[model samples]
Target: MAHWFHRNPIKATNAVTFDFGGQASTPLARNICSEARSARSNLLTIFADPTRDLTVLTDAAEKYLSILRGFVEPTVDPNSQRPPAQAPNSEGGEVESMEVSSSATGDSKLRNAIKFTWSNTLAEKHSSQHDFVFEQINILFNIALWHTKHAAALAGAKEDIAEDDAKEVHKCLRSAAGIFNYIDDKLTVKLFERTGDGTDLDPNIIKAYAQQCTAEAQEVTVARAIELKHASNLVSSLAFETGKQFKIADNSLKAVEENLVQKWRKYLQLKATFYLSYAHCYNGQTLLAQDKCGEAVRALKESKTQFEKADDLGRSYTSTKGAGKSAKPHEHAFFRRLLPLVRRNLEKVERENGFIYYQKVPEVVPELPSKATYGLASPVEFVMPSKHEDWTAETYNGFKISKPDAEKREKEKDDAPKPVKEVPVNQTDKESSNSSGCTIS
Candidate 1:
């Protein structure tokens, strides 16, 4: 009887309910109760088990239906009038009838009644939160399929596993892929859009996702490695693009170029030496990597030297260019006159240092006298004395001689004889002097 009740609890419970209606039967009610409890216990055990075999689900579903059946009972009361038990229709008869009903009205009423009862029963037996619970169940179902595939693989029946199990695993993998794809799309869009706007998105997130994608690829077959590689390349490209954008936004190109030239120049020289040494050490001339390294080092060093020279020359040129528009004309003229002098001095220094000096000599102009006595002086001359003299006493004393010598000079001037006039020329003058001389005695 227990086996029978477990096999068909609904029929058993209905039989007991009908027997109680016709004749009072406490034994039948007790038997029905016992069967329902046993079935519920077995169902709970089956669900609690970790193994999710299809057989277990079928058993649990059967048990759940049995538990529902055991809850149905016939009410009994001798003093009160009660309605007759409605016969179970193929589609259960309506618990209530609607007045003034057309054929559509009658159908609608029956449908609403059935829907309400069925939904209420399902809710009461299950839960209001069943949607969330069912979703979790579905996820578990996928996980179960995944485990089954893994088990088959481990059991050496890899080929024999149902195609559905593989499909299930693929489905899960696809979900993970979708997540990655979404992130990739989002990052790409943001990267392109914000690139011009000059924003730096986090790089760590991209790196992490890339690692995840790579890790996920391990589960895939070798045939999919190429796909994985493509994905990885995309990630790498995005990272590179992001870094480049950041570098440009930061204006680090010039600084980086300068730094690289500075750093690599030394290594470049060593690189050539290193390659030659490597070749000799290994006794092989075909190893070109070392040579390339050396060449790179030398190239970088040369580049650095050139850059430094250019920078210095630029600074010097700018400094000597002078400043301001107003100062330019004067600066030009000054340089025009002084450039020859500067070049001459520079050449002299270079010559002293045993270097060849190649400066042009300036034309020499001879000094001219102030007086017109020299051909160099201008013909138009004023009576003004030479500007060489000043009125200072020192100038006057420069010409001073002895006073006696000065008088002697004067007497000599007096002692010099005057020239005598002819008598005929003074005859009238002599007669006039004799006529005027008589009154003077």
Candidate 2:
């Protein structure tokens, strides 16, 4: 009966096209361009008149499409053959829907219906295949996260933004957060597949992918806490889960070399400790926001231990292997900035816990100049012409060399003579001034 109900293939191939505010051949290109237009219009409108005039759902949909594109279509250099050599790079897209046909006898009408249903038309294309592609998922997660960060940055930039407007932006963030978590959950399945009953696995590649996924999972949790303001208990629980995942990845590497394994474990432990510290700090902040002072203090105290361990590990690692080598400029700068802030947070928690403060609060340091703003504030260095170069006066017919019109107006104003008028005063005031030996000239 099931076989009798099967449908026959209606067509050998089907093409898909999208009309995204206009016609486009490819769905990806059409969707991207359409969203680009909407986003551009929204931003331009906002710039012209800073008001809550945006369609929030449309904005969220645009961001969602961005994440989808990042998953399905990666940026290409056009010249490079490889897809920018991202980790676990692969090609993936919506699978073409094809009806399964066999030599078995079945009703022709039913078969035709089945084939029509299975056809790779815009309305009937299979969607499950897209979810199986891991690279696309990761890219989508990252892009969604970038959108969340973008929204936060936008909120920070506009001082006069209304509460309702801010709430709209948060709605976008919430959607992004939800998608990110979904992908994270899906990635966990891939992690287990790689682990494969804890046996018969390559030491580096498979385990490395798992570790990468778990580490990114930790970051995703942190992002959730930051953007969603997840509950303190949930955030703390996630932090512990992240630590456990790191331990699992580390433990899997035991069959490898001792020194190598030890170093890997150390690095993993270092990361886990730092993430835990960040998580605890987040939990403390969450509690503090809810007016749970005691709980906040406790969470912050726990964070201090993890932070100290991370600091110690970082120092030890640098002193040993990085003895002669200087740290990267960004790393050096980040550590320099972060250390004091960590100290301050810890101090504040301690003070809240009724500890006496012997030392005065540290002076606030002004932010160092950013490299991006260097060109804005500093003049471009003028380079002298090379000795071998010939100097010539370049002239263009379209160019104007006369003084500007503003200068001419200023000259006319200066040349114009001024007219003066005499001031009138009350007779009594004038007489009093004269008696007091004072007079208006």
Candidate 3:
């Protein structure tokens, strides 16, 4: 039964719910790996045959979404009002099933007679909180990608997908966006928590995941524009958010590129460029839809330039020793595939609306200054030591200091003063004092 459920979750969930009558006593638990596998399989099936029935593919995606949501952000079950179950050792308690094997008895002694069943908590501890969410994001992205492609193909065939299951497609895209939004909101909370308390975890992981969510959300928004044949309100607003997300992602990728050296830096930079080009490409489409031909041209041009840069860097990264062997052929295939569309659209827009007000301007990014100049340890001042009237000081190869001797002065006062003739006294003898002592200051 577990194998069947793992293989087919949608039907299994339905069966379990029906058998238990929506109660929690049956303990219908979900396996994250199994769910992820099922989702990936569904996506691969769609990719295998793009012309497959959209209805079946969409149903599979929705089911996978439900399963994934349970993993990362499970909602309170409405039927969870029943009392909790006691432990297996208590009255009316249920023992969790476990497998036990027995070996042949040898010389009146039994081997492997006892077996212990490990609880679910042991497994749960091994999986980090972010792991499940990351997996879900990957699945959701593929689902959204499938929806976008299918919906756009339908739009192309029928001028608009509004009449033919448009609502379903819209729902899928919106769910994808919702998943992304949920991730972003929770990630913000996690970051705040880590900020207040010292945490050893690297925040770059969350930042990278946030970038994926934003990029996938942007893809959904762009697909919606394409399907609806308009981009005035919804698309325009989404473009603003998407652009901000792209900027954040760019900063994160810059940090990553800085940490790497030589070929790796170029490789990461190329990946960053590929991600940015998608944003630019979609933003260009949005601008063109709004009839801002000049801005649209600029965005599209930027997209094309980024594509060229990515290609060159990618080639450079691959030409290095050992990098080519591990290179992924589909690494930036999406960007490459989209570049021609951007170029074609740019030409179409220019031909329809002449490039009268378009002009390029050069911009420079100055290096950021060091923090030491105005930082906490800045504004230093020098101080000089002051000499006291009672002390004598000298510096040569070493410093010698002399201070008045109170005891010697008192003794001189106590003793009878000897009158000295004012005959010739050497300058050094006049400067010497028996009433003073010297110390390093």
Candidate 4:
């Protein structure tokens, strides 16, 4: 279970005390900056291990992000925008006052001179910037990653997980999805520029992470439906949707570095194939329940094909090189648990088709059941927190910024590369002895 998730590490950084010029009249700015930095440090350094408490890490993330908001525009007041960085994501979206340089925001007068240095998770190297927005984006990425880690912890618990724990798993994943969505929908457009694949702020990486979380959350929904013994159609519908979700996530990373992302892509591929098997297996059950022996026999055969494909991926997912721990999903009981069920169902249907129904098995597999009508996962709504009360415009405007290199800005604008976009795949199904998610590995 430790290897269940291929988590991206947080941006590491050296410390900086927010020491400003001696002209300041108040300690208010210093205190807020110090606490914000401390919270950030604490958040980044948390071990990526799943054994840690979820609530502790979650609170620390919010505390840091809310305080850091003070140093930026529109968050601190109706007006505090900063000067433009190298360039915007021009791939398209909302660009705030970030593009418009105006002294009225006190943006030109008080550049927050404290240089924030942070490492890129994939690049495994540090890049320093005077940008508060840089800190914001990185901090948001870490918190979202933490939620995925917590979901793993809950699912990987040594004891059988309780129903409430399943709910927590669902909640944690959706929370991760929401933060990632916020990054794509709101924050990335505000980025002075795309940090490229070397950095987590790259749009394609964000989309992949967002889709994975949303898909993983639905895996929980599938497990819950089975535990509750929901209808055959509902279970098959959900399982089909889960497979589709995993495909989208895998597709999002199509052009990401193979050395960096191949293992994760393999995990998505295996899961997609696994859940397609589930969808087929259950759709077969739905058909059997409705006495459509011909379709049931056909669907079961399709499930067998997908199941074999997932079994093949299990090995590759283990061998593939990439960041984070490699999962032993092939060996995990959760993965093998479906085989007996599929076999039993397929055997039953084939026997019935021959003796009772006398229906002919068709060559074509039935189309995948329609998308689930309900109980699918959606991102929890996320809005940037209001700036901490202590960070009034007066306190924020006191500090000046370290200006970005104008030359480098122009160069990056000319040199920025197009983003990588890929297609994806995925797993999970029923008659389980217990209720838990597939991502638990």
Candidate 5:
């Protein structure tokens, strides 16, 4: 479990007192700053061990986010750094994977009062910004990572995973995907600038992470179906969809620098291939059930070929250089147990074809399933936490913002075209749940 998932390191930052109160320090202002720091401290401490109780990890993350919202609430600026016309925060003309808000990205005096510094997930140099949105971005990113770690812990907690544990594992990965999507959708677009190489803020990296988490979550569901002895077609469909998700995730990394994520890519690639094998193996079972033993043999042969490819990729993944810790997915029974099952099915189908059905093996391979109908995983859409009550109107206007010089403000207006936002993902994802932000459906 320790090295099951690759995690970005916790960002290190120099502590800054959020003292926007200046000379007229109201009691509320001091309290706000104090509470903000305390919230941040608790979040950092909790992140140290993501394998703890699911509730504890999520609560800590959300608490910091809620209070931080008060600091980043929109403020008017004649010389806004963003474009006059707001655009979507999406790419490649796909549906907006995240909810894009029209609220102004804060250019407030308090926003620049405290600078936030965070190191890259790799050992690369860090990105530092005086903007409050920068802090929010880092917080949201780490929150997503914490959810992934929690999912990994649950999945590998024991060899024989309980039904409840599997459910939680599935839920956590979807939640993680939601957060990563949020960062890509809402927060990162608000940054004045991103000034670090190999930073986690890269859109391709975010998408890759999001896709991988979703695929991984679906993996748990597939295991559950198999464990419960679900119908062969159902399992095949689920496995096929899971592998497709992983492939999409792998393809997203094409634009990313290979040295930064070769191992990570290999891991995703093997998972993709491994799941394809699982799909074919189960598919062969389904074919055998229909007495199409010849077609079953063909599917099982393809399954065996995919399994071999995955095994070779597994060895390469272990040896490849990359950022983050190594993963031992091949060591898991969830992965190792598939080949024997495939072999057994192949043997049975070949014997049955010779004796019973007598159908000839076609010249071409049979088609693998296109997708899963019942258990295809999607991101558990994330909603940003509402501002804490401490950010009430009276408390909010208490601190006077230091006005920026007109010349400097004018100079800082970025002429860059705003990101075009895409359609929102489940804008209606409102359901009450105790697991984490959104209920696992």
Candidate 6:
């Protein structure tokens, strides 16, 4: 035996001591409890994650199938069994013949007999397995319905159900049909097992199920058609509005218009492609829906291209050296008149491109000379000098000497006699007297 210590005031001044077995059990229980709590928390965390939720859904589907299988068939107990009740005879004696005649003559009597026989057979065949199958069908149908509704809510089409939702509805109907098919097959199997022939048993149940499937499929088709029509109308309206807003005035605005047209065209082309693809999927031929979509796209693209070209022309016109600048004073007036057209076109582009159309236009300065350099006079005159003659200082000041005064001064200087030089008076007299005497002798 193991001894356990007890705390006593007399022994060690301790207040008390617990039994070893109980104390050991307490620690073990706490450890187990702590582990269990941690496991539960971890499980809860995993369940909260979305990925885990999808996995759970899948698992649930599989489990539902298992439950369905269980309902479809069950093991029969060998003991405590009783014989089935005897059914009324169809041909029982003259009293019997009379009785049979009475039974067969009335519709209500005949119907009741058939119903009772059929009910008895069904009860005999009923199994947990069949119930399980029904449960599985129900579960799948509900799950599909839930997914459909969830998707519809997400799409903001509370009133308008999507194709996928419609498909789910079909699936549910098909599941119901499947239940009937299963029962029919089971009935056939039982008939064959009992009489080695199943051709004689009525196929009303399977036929009815198939007919229901057909009806559901038709409904889905109708729903899809309606949805497609609505979508087409919406897209058409948008495309029309886009086309209406583009304008073609002024070079800058024209460029914007062209770009917008191109964008709109591309958008139309994309939309048409989508519609054509949808048409192909739906196998729709009514109204030549696919062809119309293609045509619309092409037409829009061509229109956009033409608009772009027009814009290019406008840009070229405005971009010319003297575009905004006028040689005449009235040119500004012309531009002012055209300003409205430019504004309208710009607005059109803005509508088409959304935020992209609002981009800044490049700054363009007019080429006209500044007013300070070129006077405001019309028919500007340029007075050029007669020739490349050098201008004298006086000529530059606008003061000129008269030609007659210049000529008079020149003649006076030329005609005036030179003064005679007087030699020394004595030398000059002697030379002159000697020359005179020589000439006289």
Runs in model 5 deviating more than 4 A are 1-4, 19-24, 74-108, 404-441
Question: Which 10 consecutive residues of model 3 have the lowest summed lDDT?
Answer: 1-10
> Across residues 96-155, which tens digit of lDDT does each residue of candidate 4 receive?
333245345434223334556666656654565556777677678767876787777677
Q: Which lDDT tens digits does candidate 2 get at residues 1-441?
A: 000000011111111111222212244444443453454334323321212334543454444344333222223334543311111212453212111121122111111110100111111222111121332343333334333333433343333446564544445444444454444444435422332222112334234334434343344444445456556456555555555555665666666545323433455566567656765665665655665556666666666777778777655544332101221211332223434545676566557555532333223321111221111111112121121111111111111112123444334311211111112111111212222111111
Candidate 1, 1-441: lDDT as tens digits: 000000000000001121112121234444443554464445434433223454564455445343332221112233444432333323665322221131232121111110000001001121111111121222222222232222222222231334455343333333333333343343244221221111111223222222222222222321132224433222222222322232232232233223222212221222222222211211111111233223223323332333344334323332342111011111222112323432343343334334332322223211111211211101111121121112122221121111122344334221211111111100011212321111100
Measured by C-alpha RMSD in angstroms, how accurate is candidate 5? 11.8
Provide the lDDT at 134 for model 5: 90
Question: How far out, in Å, is residue 41 in model 1?
Answer: 1.2
Off by over 4 Å in 3: 1-200, 232-240, 250-300, 310-333, 349-441
Rank list by lDDT: 5, 4, 3, 2, 6, 1
Q: Where does candidate 1 stray beyond 4 Å?
A: 1-25, 69-161, 164-441
Question: Can you tell me which runs of candidate 4 are displaced by over 4 Å?
Answer: 1-3, 21-25, 45-50, 74-112, 400-441
lDDT (Cα) of model 5: 0.71
- At residue 16, candidate 5 shows an lDDT of 59
TM-score of each: 0.18, 0.32, 0.33, 0.82, 0.81, 0.21
lDDT of each: 0.25, 0.36, 0.36, 0.70, 0.71, 0.26
Worst 10 residues of 5 by lDDT: 421-430
Question: Which tens-of-lDDT digit does each residue in 1-441 have in candidate 3?
Answer: 000000000000000111111111222321332443565455545533333567777667666555544333322224553322222423554532211110021110011111111111001111112123344433443444344344333322322235435444344334434433444454334321232111112244334433533343354445455456553334434434444454564465444323222433343455556545655666666666666666667776776786787677666655543211223212322334657776886686666456453533213211111221110111111111121111111111011112223465344212221221111111111122521111000
lDDT of 3: 0.36
| 1 versus 2: better TM-score goes to | 2
